[model samples]
Target: MKKIKCLGLVWLLASGLTGFAKDYPVSSAKELSALSLKPGDRVLMKAGEWKDQQLKFKGNGVKGRPIVLMAANAGKTVLNGNSTLDIDGSWLVVDGLSFANGRLDSGEVVNFSEKSFSCRLTNTSVIDYNSSDDKVDYTWVSLRGTHNRVDHCLLKGKNHQGVTMVVWLSEKPNYHQIDHNYFGPRPELGRNGGETIRIGTSTWSFHDSFTLVEENIFEHCDGEIEAVSVKSGRNIVRNNLFYECKATLTLRHGNHSEVIGNYFIGNGKPGTGGVRIIGEDHNVRDNYFQDLTGTGNSAAISVMAGLPNPILVSHWQVKNARITDNLILNCKEPFAIAAGYRKDRYLPALNTYFAKNIILSNVSPLKVYDEKVVVNFEDNLIFSTAFSGEKGRGFELRNEQLKKGSSGLFLRPGQADFKPFWESEQIGPGWFLDINKKFTIN
Candidate 1:
């Protein structure tokens, strides 16, 4: 008997059998119900490779301590070759495993099954979980339940037609929290619809998600123009670090969302961008945009227009947006109005506020596609060798130039630990002087 010591259980290493917790074929809904797990209960799956294992992990747990299903060893309980997990329960947690070798047609590597509530998927990983065959589409992780969270996990190598992670909305709002995770490289799909994260689909853009995507790192995610495509209302994207991603965080649909306290560091890379705005009643504030080189639609910040009397699926007109207290540095286009999408009888952006921002050393600070788009631009500082005292291109050109003082402002910006080094004097305007640890892959 080969001894295998594990969390909350012991197992035979040779036979891949466990001592504690139920061991049943994860193939039946009736079998899972038979477990009848409760609060503080634990289940340990058999340690081995599971190919195409489709099962429902069901149980209920109370607050403070949720039920858990853990691997015999971290990263040892491998699920491969189109493997999928459907978690169905309240206050359950899945921890310490890896799901890999997923096929293209594999719908979702892991899904918080419908009706699940207060669940979490933490400290796990999903790598290379994508559709291998062409013309097939699938999401890597689908979050369908409510009040769930995905944290301290690693999701990488998503090269397929669909999004890497998604929050599917329903009759009730999905108040999900996606935090402290690492999103790895996703190569350019050369077409549309390869977003890193999509909050909700356009089919139900009117739904209120109330989701939060914060403290995550998006590394080299060159999938499409939109990195985190928001299609629902009242969502929040904050405290995230987007490093050299050749895309923008687009508010693609709905309204009343906020993107704040995020760091977008392009390091002078081509195609790298900051944020794109759509719809109305949104707030994009207290963010840092540095070294972005995208010119037109991929500008550091692009506000989009919409068609007249648009439907929920269509892009809505930008209205009553508050874009303030941001720091934009060394970008090609810091501000763009009606960016890159113009056709038919379009409605222009209106009643926007751009205030108290500090912009520096951009090739072109403002890009205006629709001159009819009006904004209340006030109290903004521009410190550049280029244009000065110009009210034409979205800037008012206030008095005195701001300088990047004698600090390691550009020190090793291409490295993984790269961040703009700001002196104590230049520490205001929502920019931080320290290394943003959320910028790394770890």
Candidate 2:
């Protein structure tokens, strides 16, 4: 009897798996629409062209078992000619698809609806997907849900008015993670408003999205001033490479965020900027900025002054910033304290700390216009630059020289080797354990 009960339990488990886990091979939009999708459903697209098909995927799967929608083959299935998908539910995964040679006629290419949660789009590519109208604005992917992820996707040739992707934060924190994606070749829009990724808009900029953008390559993003204009608070931009882009990663609107471990290789380009810092309590550390030629407002690191406490909606005052452990090399105007400041009675940057930073290359490192501004500069090493004779009210200036004719990459004394190179300080973030890497691209 016990042996029969064991065999009966095995049959029941097999019956349960067959009852719930189903693979639906869809060809037409009507066929996909006709199905009543439940949890643990796998909707697989056949290997063919899906043109002009605006399909909407809707299902609410639980946490451990997500509803999946993938192509039959990884890069074989193509979505062309104004083809798009609207994800409307939670815990859904769309993967292994490609959108090529398409022009969206009206709306977004992929839109996560406002009610969705924990959905993901992974291992996909969208190439040359634009709008039919140049004047009309449309986002490639507009993420409106919380805890959604877009990872390992290749997005290229966005030559339109709006952003490539956006994490729109409304009532709660989105907590989205955009990792290991390739943002390639966004040519210069003749006008403005061509950001690659915008976290939030102006009215919702004060909210905390807490988004994490990591290990992505932003190449030739020549749209406007901000390649990734971070407008929301508590967002993290880390371990990304900005290669020869005409814009910088700007913390334009939010506060209490951090930009760390990013590599900015300008390759002697004229307008390639590194990091533009605005707002308050931002931690800019452990990054490498080199070979840039951007000046003035487009410097390697620009610290904007604040508007006087006025009666309007304006930019925030730069306060309580901790800028440390950076290696700035061979860039024109690497550090600017009161960047883009005029003489017309503005609020100064206050309570900012600049320490443990090493600046090499020519002179003219710091650019401070306001004399009454509050900044603390200490323990920073300089090769051929000068910014501080006095840092604070009674503080002493401590800009240590690298001893002219010193050699190697700051490893040996007066033994210079090749061009600028840095062995950065190793820091283990609490997110990762026991992994020792200097600016490790996460």
Candidate 3:
């Protein structure tokens, strides 16, 4: 009786009584759309170029059992030439696909719909997928909904205008995670709307995005001044590498965001900026800014002055900013206080605190635009080749010789043990091994 019962259970599982997951091999978009996918089901695309295909993958799966859409062979399936993907479901995963040699005439290349929750897009590549006309604006990736993630992807060569990736927010908080990706080589668009990543728009700036952007690399992404524009509240940008990118990660709107542990390596490039502050209660800490040449409003650290009684869409006064424990090495302008101050825009930063920072620069460390700006500095250190009895209210000058590390980074004595948090192997796809070959940390 026991042997007969065990055999009966096996037969029931095999005969689909237990709802076993299955894999469907699909060749065309029409074939893929015909199937109704369930949880733990996988739709595998054939390993070839799928051109001019508009794929809308819509399914609902519970937690721990996601519906997956992937290539039969990883990195071998390409969607090119007017191809786009719309993920409009919950707990879905899209992995190992490539979008190259293509341009979307309208809409985004990859869009997570407004109702897509707990969805993820991983190990994908969107390369050179731009419209031929630069004026025709279309985004590459549009992330919406809550708890969505875009990770381990390579997004590069976006020459046309529009954000490379955007996190669209609704009335509620969208907790998105954008990490471990490579954003590379977007040339100057010479206008606005060229940000590599924008969290929220001006209309949704007051909403709480709760987004986290970390462990990514921004290489030569000089589309506009703002590389990663934070326009929402309570977001975090941490542990990312900005490699020779001629732009600043601007907190353009919203409040109470944080920028932490990021490395900005300019390599003495022109117009290379670090971070720009324009909000309230934002914290910028534990970041390293090296070899940047941008000055004035594009300094390594800039705090913008606001307009009197500014509108919601305009610049707001930076209040209660905490800039702490940052390393500014060989930068042209280390700090720009009251950066955009003018006659019309005369409201300076208020109650800001700069504490425990290390500044090693050739020029003056601080550029105070207005005398009414209330900034408190405490326990900062300045390393200089010639001290000459330099003294300040909050800084101590030390004549120290800097030495270069094995990876061509100049460090002060006892600071040689500082290692980068994010590495090339930790970010991007495994097949793209040359992610950070140009900049290697010791």
lDDT of 3 at 347: 89
Clashing pairs in 1: 104-131, 104-132
Q: State the lDDT of candidate 1 residue by residue for 247-303, as single tens digits.
A: 999999878999998888898778999989888899999898888888766888888
In lDDT terms, how accurate is model 3?
0.88
lDDT of 2 by residue, 148-182 (tens): 99887878898888888988989789999998777
Q: List TM-scores for all candidates, in order.
A: 0.83, 0.84, 0.93
Candidate 2's C-alpha runs over 4 A off are: 1-19, 309-313, 343-345, 385-442
lDDT of 3 by residue, 1-442 (tens): 9999999999865443455789999988888899898888899999999999989898886677789999989899999989899999999999999999898777899999999999999999999998889988999999998999999999999999789999998999999999999898999999998999999998888889999999998999899999999999999999999998899999999999999989899988899999999989999998989989888778999999898887778889899999999989988889998988899988889899999998887778888888788788888898865333337778888777667765566664577544454533467876666775658433
Give the lowest summed-lDDT range of ten residues in model 3. Answer: 416-425
What ranking of all candidate models by lDDT puts the best one first?
Answer: 3, 2, 1
Among all windows of 10 consecutive residues in model 1, the one with the lowest summed lDDT is: 423-432
- The numbered model that scores best in TM-score is 3
Best of the candidates, lDDT? 3
lDDT of 2 at 180: 74
Q: Candidate 1: misplaced stretches above 4 Å? A: 1-34, 389-442
Write down the RMSD of all candidates, one decimal each.
Answer: 9.2, 6.8, 3.4
